[model samples]
Target: MDHRDMRISDAERERVVAQLNTAVAEGRLTIAEFEDRVDGVLRARTFGEIEPYVTDLPVQQVKPPEESELRSRSSSLKRRGRWTVPRRLTIVTLSSSVKLDFTEAIFGAAVVDVVLDAHSSSVELVLPAGAVADVDSIYTHASTVKSRIEPSGGGVQFRISGEVSTSSVKLRYQRRFWRWRW
Candidate 1:
């Protein structure tokens, strides 16, 4: 028997479904195509049956980078709008301001690891809805860390770790209008 004849497990089927979801979110597939492919994946029972649904779709395997760093000495660093959020990010600054807005940013992974190293500066993270952050690993001296959003069990999480000396770090959700929280 060929390897393609092997039976497929639910996990394998769900992986394909996740790829299909990403495809639709990236606009690579229309809603109709995504629905059709998801339906096919649900019915697939063998490797051969699942091969065709994603044969033409591009692979979006999330591979985390070793470490990407952004260093600033006297200027402000801002990352906002539809940008790709690195799996591991290191922000180093001195006497500067840093703001990372993830409202429309693309997440390569469910959790983002941010390492902060600042002196006499301020760092702010503007998270989107349904996202939470963990900042317990950060070490602060003569600084303050504040997060308006409560940490939850699931969804997108930010693992913030590092040191902030004479600096501050804050986490807040994106606001819509002056009174709307959307």
Candidate 2:
């Protein structure tokens, strides 16, 4: 997607700069290189402009199984009833704010239904749990979840230093009995 389409916010840019600074301090980037790249990021007006530099930086990796296999398995597993666990989650972000809520109870579990709403700015909906059986299920196939949930609770609030906004979030709860579920 185009950097303009990505709609990254100023706060996110600051965050990226902070991370870059850390990397430089740790010797991951030389002072001169750091200053140059940092300047580039600061000057960047779109996500596309900042992506090439940041995409290569060290980050976590998560990949899903082949789609065919996943679909076939999901279909077969659907018959078992016990093989799948469905949960309902409602996430609400306040005006001009971004939020993420994770429940330890569902940590590493499968998310069947994810509901998201955004009003302004950009929202990032992330599932960092390793226990989730199908990240693609909620993200790609279902499309209920977005790469970044936009700021929807209200308008975006620019904070000078303190908390910029408050996010109201909720996640539904359910458990599957399948032994291999995960």
Candidate 3:
């Protein structure tokens, strides 16, 4: 089979997702457009199926932020609007809160691994409709986790592993159940 005809890998799909996220982050795409492309990315089986998503976007030469800065903890943090989504993001807090809304935030990968280090703190992630968040493992120590993450059709994959201590880890999905496209 030709290169484009070969089956794609998870990493490849992620790379494409990252690119699509980047395109949206740079104002080249609207949320609806990105969502549509993400659906195509997740369901894509071959490279030929995903090339169209980023064909019109320019290649970014800027390097992503350093690990130290990206992994830093914050208090009362909220990530909204257009922001770059890293491959792996660790949300940490001592005794505060962090809210990440992916409804408008751009994704950097198809399967973004999100680590919630809710140490005496709380973490809330707001995902778009159809997005799936797979809680790989959750550990609660004097904490509570309210997850609305369930398997859904046609969206990105989020692998979540976290420890909640005297804190809460919540995954929220927005959009009416009756309204869906994909």
Candidate 4:
């Protein structure tokens, strides 16, 4: 698909930068070239603007996500590994399970907001090291909420707020390589 005209998210730019870094490590790009592309990516505002920087370099499908929302109804959904984190998200799970792992997520913004709505469901948040989460607005009724991470300054901050009804929500920090742990 031609996505050059689409507006690019900061997370998308970061993703391309990471790909460039890998290319340099693999000897596919020189240090100077990588530096130049990196600069271009950070300054890019549109998809077209960043295409040239990674056109010749290897990359995954760089299409920007339409929006930032994951919903499940009586089913299971998981997000992990090399996914792009949107600027804002709204996740709703209805009597289902949803796990959002941000350890390897490409952050699109320095500050992100996540709204979670759970109903008789389980929601798990696996955060990246040095990332902090604030749940001051989270409210629950007859539910279990456990967090292993205390609010603190970190590389990327996720401001979370939501309502849970008869469900469980847990938050923790996990190593990027550890996917088995919930």
Which has the greatest lDDT? 1
Worst 10 residues of 2 by lDDT: 68-77
Instruction: Give the per-residue lDDT of model 4 (tens digit) for 1-182.
Output: 66877889666676788889889989999999988889988988899998889879765655445457888999999988877788788998999998888977877577788898899999999988778888778888999888888667657887888899999988898844556554
The candidate with the higher lDDT, 1 or 4, is: 1
Global Cα RMSD, each model: 8.0, 18.4, 8.3, 9.7
Instruction: Please list the residue runs of candidate 3 whose C-alpha ends up more than 4 Å from where it truly belongs after superposition.
Output: 1-74, 175-182
Reference-based TM-score of each model:
0.65, 0.33, 0.58, 0.64
Q: Specify the highest-TM-score model's number.
A: 1
Candidates arranged by lDDT, highest first: 1, 4, 3, 2
Name the weakest run of 10 consecutive residues (lDDT summed) in model 1: 59-68
lDDT of 3 by residue, 74-119 (tens): 4588778656677788777787877778875556556778777777
Which of candidates 2 and 4 reaches a greater TM-score?
4
For model 1 the local lDDT of residue 140 reads 92
> lDDT, candidate 3, residue 74?
45
Candidate 3: RMSD to truth: 8.3
